[model samples]
Target chain A: MDSAGVLLDAQGLGRFVPGTQQWLLRDVSLAVRGGDRLAIVGPTGSGKTLLLRSLALLDPIDEGRVLWLSQTISARLVPAFRSQATYLHQRPALIEGTVEDNLRLPFTFRIHAHQDFDRRRVASMLEMVGRGADFLARSWHDLSGGEAQIVALVRALQLNPTVLLLDEPTASLDASTTQTIERLISHWHERTNGKRALIWVTHDRQQSTRVAQRVVQMNAGKLLEGT
Target chain B: MTVDGYIELKAWQVAIAASLVLLNAAISLGLQLGLGRSLVVASMRMVVQLLLIGYVLRWVFQSDSVLTVLALAVIMTIIAGVAAVRRTERRYPGVYWASSVSVLVSSWLVTSFGIAAVLQKADTWYEPQYAIPILGMILGNTLNGISLGLNRLEDELVVHRNLVEMSLTLGATSWEAARGPVRQAVRTGMIPMINSMMVTGIVSLPGMMTGQLLSGVSPLQAVKYQIVIMFLIASGTALGTVGVVLLSFRRLFNRNHQFQSGLLTAAGHK
Candidate 1:
């Protein structure tokens, strides 16, 4: 990894539920460079999701500092930092709207309204994800699980985020759909010129090996190996 | 019979009406027995609360003092707020206070405006009969609505938290992330009042109309009062529910826009 490619650096992070001594993610540290494809492998309830949430700045860390580009983006800037780093949920949460509406959702926000709204780009993105022109107008309920996941990924990609935190993006899909999605992700990475880094949280070891340039294994909230 | 004199009804008539009221209570009891613990608690609360309210109303109306009536209304607002917060999550500290203010302000506006300006032509108005019952109906509806809104919003925060997080990551503000669920919750919360509004006169005669008729008012006058009361109740509920939910959102989230665990109770706990 390039020295200047330290897009995300986290240290000494701990999160605890009140009235419980058990820390969800304790004493964890990780650094990722641009072009780094990192897979966070862990079993269920092993804090892989928690770590991803912390990295995405979706959850406030009890004790930690996350450095992004030589600046500490603390809890105060979590929302702003998170906006630049897409966090795709384990299950794609499709809103009650068409595929096009989902893709264009970010621009609806006042903070992101100034970003260029390109319909052609969205159509092309959807096409690359194995969707057709009619998909944009299709309601959310119409999409299968795999299709919904792809749409969600495309929506995140449309924001032109610097990093992607994927929580088992293909966990619920069939083998064929998973392979298709994998190809789409590869295509997206290439298209973005590798300016983006990915932190994929997954339980499938093979899937991790397939995408990870660097791998970290977590067990019960601690980074056990493969840093 | 003198027009201003209190006409004491025969013992049998009073007993029959009391029995009818008891019959309604027994029906409520049956519903409570069927639903189990929460409904039972709610029924018990309703019984105790109404009895207390009865005594309180008697005192206020007999005194006919503005201060006493206003004080009683304030108490009702406070209770409504407490109920809203408790129904959501008792662990959310400082939310109840804000809920109270919202409930008070919204209900006060509706009742005062409806009674003083719309119903009665009084310049400086404080009539316990009009104000107190209106206040009770408004507070009760708002209390139920606020409870629904708060409960739904909190559940959304817990269950669909990922969607909220996703929105935040997608550059949506805290309010923007919460807005969809809030709107859905508020809309859902208003449904009971909406249904009540829809079937006000058709399905059953509401209590206010029945009470007015018992008090020797004409059927037309009673109907008009019920209509006004229903409209005001719906208005109060919607306004108060919106106000409390919006205000409670501030307390539910931290400066970082993340929901604090303290505000959440474990599922199956409530």
Candidate 2:
């Protein structure tokens, strides 16, 4: 980690089952600097999801701590940290509403109230993936698997978090859809102009190498260097 | 013991009326309804509880102290809170306080307002006859509402935790993430009351009004009191159920706006 340029860091991070002396993740550490796309690959139950969620500060950590911009993120700052370091899950859970309603959800928060929902921005983002503004009016339940995930991506991008923790976001999608998602992400990344970073968790090695400049492996909760 | 126009039944007569449950228990044994033992035990408990309450109410009536009434009211609220929490079959930290607030705020407000302001029986405002039974009725109904609401809230929150985290990731607060479940819980909690309200006059007569009519009270007077009590129940339940749900949902998230799943003793169970 380049301490000065590091945007997010997890120092000797650990997680244990609620009861008993069992470690789900132990002594795992990671750092994502601005403009870095880090991809973590591992087998099922290898804790890639756990590590990504831990780094995102979504899961409760039993050991060590996370730092936003090298400053340790305490309980008080976790929400603020979460707002900046967002996590996107593989399965999208959209609320019961039109696509536009789902997109407008974040601004309803006190944290995001100052930022108005910009329809044109969202429409333009959709257009990048061959979707039009009419996509906004699509009902949540009626959305295809690819489209829902796309909307979810758009929703997360609208917040413009400094770091994104993508957990198998395209694992279930077709090749075309996966490429569209990747394009959308790199497009968003380019738009940020080296100010943002991303950590992708994928099982696909070639795709991981293609997406991330720095690829790592997580197995049974321990993070290891990729060959 | 004829204090007024109300006809009082003797202890033996009351015992005879209560003995009918023994026959029901026997029929349950014969028909194999699977609740024979439970029926007997529940009936015995009911008898014991009602008899104890009867004697306690006698004492309360004789004393006629507002402090005693208030103390009893507090006890009722505390029990209601505990009972509601228990019904969830899941433990939630600090939910008792939320439930107590809900019960006290709603039941107390409705009961006090009904007797003192609506009925204009300031002389017997806190009296045992006026207060205890009314309090009992409201507490029982609101207890059911709050418990149902709380259980639904917890269940919904747990089942939809992923969605909640999704919103949090999108820069939403804990409240904003859980907005849907909290509202659903409130609505789910008041469902029983709403259903009761819908069928009150047509399907079945309410217990309170029935008791009044059996005691030879005028139909008009009984209906007037019934209407007042029903309105009181509806409003109290709405306010109290909503209050408990909101507070309960608040506790599910901490100061940092993270969903505290540890608060749940069990999840995803009906």
Model 1 lDDT tens row, A18-93: 5577788899988877788889887799999888888777777788867788688755666677777778887888
Tens digits of per-residue lDDT, candidate 2, A104-218, equal: 9888878787899998999899999999878899999999999999999999898888898999999999999999999999988878679999999999998998789999988
Indicate the worst ten consecutive residues by lDDT in candidate 1 chain B: B1-10
Best by TM-score: 2
What are the runs in model 2 whose C-alpha is more than 4 Å off? A19-21, A71-80, A132-134, B1-3, B11-45, B63-74, B115-126, B194-203, B267-270
TM-scores of the models, in the order given: 0.82, 0.86
Model 1: how far residue B233 lies from native, Å: 3.0
Query: Which structure among the candidates has the greatest DockQ?
Result: 2
CA displacement after TM-score superposition, residue A76 of candidate 2 (Å)? 6.6
TM-score of chain B, candidate 2? 0.91
- Isolated chain B TM-score per model: 0.79, 0.91
Off by over 4 Å in 1: A1-3, A74-77, A137-139, A192-194, A224-227, B1-7, B18-55, B63-67, B83-95, B114-127, B155-159, B194-206, B213-231, B259-262, B266-270
Candidate 1 CAPRI level: medium
Return model 2's CA RMSD, one decimal.
3.4
